[model samples]
Target: MFKDSKKKLSAPATDTLLANGTSFEGTIEAEANIRIDGHFQGDIRSTRTVVIGESAVVRSDIIARDVILAGKVFGSITTEGRLTITPTGELYGKVAVAALVISEGGVLDGTSQMIRTKDAEPSASTDDSDLETQSGTRKDRDTSQATLQSETG
Candidate 1:
């Protein structure tokens, strides 16, 4: 029905997927989630989450609400929510995110910036605690914050 189609269009896309082993070259935009596990060369913009799989190879700038990377990227990434890098993740460009978590063996060959919204304020739901990291050699740091950042080699 036309109502069903309209509902689908308004709902957030939870699966905008690009499988591994495939190669693509163009711009990608999504309203919610986008997962990529292939070779890509272009720009990516998402209003929600962006996930890059382990075997993926990307060359583009990305702007999203959140990002999870386990592959390799050669461009800048901006996220307002969080950016998490698994052990196999490797990035070679700049990043701007609200929260960043890099596990041991993950690589970040560029700089990072932490940003917070203007209306951001301390609240009961926000935990500002120090996190113990088993990764980078840096000393333990207090991570209790609305903005969290940890760097790894």
Candidate 2:
């Protein structure tokens, strides 16, 4: 019925889980949340939160609304909301986020770019999907060895 369809549209998506001892290698695209407690290698794109459990080992590029890392990640991560790294987490790559929370004992061995909503004008929205996507050539800055950049509409 129409009522059921409406409910389904508004209801939260069921989270996808990869339990311990599992290993996945490829691209993962999801509209719902995902929790990984095993090993993953590739890219992960999601409209919802992505949680990497304490026993997880991830090596990929991640794009999501929010990312919670309590394990190890080796790649780039872009988050429109908040990126939280727990005490036992270790991240070894670049990160772009609106907000970042790193707990004690957490280690981030790369640069981070803080996306500013005010600077992203015209659209007046900070949603990642609203921005135009483009690939580019790299330019070395005189700053640190690491480079952080923000992409907006």
Candidate 3:
């Protein structure tokens, strides 16, 4: 009753949320954008975007068009578009993404494999100013907490 199928096909997908102070464990498959700001343990398969808030703690594999991470994830993440990790984000598993952006303060403690996107040329380089190829020890960092401003921002 809340949505029409025709409109859903034409309109942009809405954002869905897993709020802070909450915990969940299961598989999630959706057409809309998904955001998490709490604890989760499962697999997430989405045709759209998936955003992990700075306060979130997740242990699941994620497959999405794009992912913006500002939290902690203990599983692999595969994306067709790009995976942007904010300063507070941390990932501990493998990632296969077409594009990746890790802010200065972000941390990734696993292997990252880059895939070629349709838009990228065969000779195009994946090395950008924000990307680095190196090996280092996983630093000991404390997980921070923050409150979500609104559900659908």
Candidate 4:
């Protein structure tokens, strides 16, 4: 038997609201999603996603899979996947992420570097080819080794 409750049984879990009246100063770790509407003064680390609500004010570094900001943040941010700044968001920090999106009215200060984690590893073929090329350059190696020996002597 399935029946709907007259009243809402549970609240949505995707969006966690730290209402305006609350203030926290510590690291926040969550697997789902988090939204802050209050003042926070610490690091925010998550495996899922994070959203800084428009009324929220944060002053700490952030690490997450994805982050959406619509508030004020005064710290560096590192995202494994993507980072999005909404029109009302104001961010002032360096950002390292795979991808970034900033709305027209969003404000971002400091540098942003897009890095690919998987691509950082050299391919097997490339490594092998590089090794082969280096090994084939006998003259270069000999000259360098000779110079090192002379300097030591």
Best prediction by TM-score? 3
Q: What is the TM-score of each candidate against the true structure?
A: 0.69, 0.69, 0.70, 0.69
Say what the RMSD of model 2 is: 14.2
TM-score of 2: 0.69
Model 4 spans with C-alpha error above 4 angstroms: 1-15, 119-153
What is the clash tally of candidate 4?
A: 0
- Indicate the worst ten consecutive residues by lDDT in candidate 3: 136-145
For model 3, the stretches where C-alpha displacement exceeds 4 angstroms are: 1-14, 121-153
Per-residue alpha-carbon lDDT of candidate 2 for residues 1-153, written as tens digits (9 for 90 to 100): 345543211213448998889999999999999998899999999999898889999999999998989899999999998898988889999999999999889999999999875555456455664343321112234222353333221
Summarize candidate 1's per-residue lDDT along 109-153 as a digit string, tens digits. 999998886557555564434223433224333443323543431
Q: Give residue 68's lDDT in candidate 4 (0 to 100).
A: 85
List residue ranges in candidate 2 displaced over 4 A.
1-14, 118-153
lDDT of 3 by residue, 17-119 (tens): 9999999999999998998999999999999999998899999999999998899999999999889888899999999999999988999999999988776
Residue pairs with backbone overlap in model 4: none
Clashing pairs in 3: none
lDDT of each: 0.83, 0.84, 0.85, 0.85
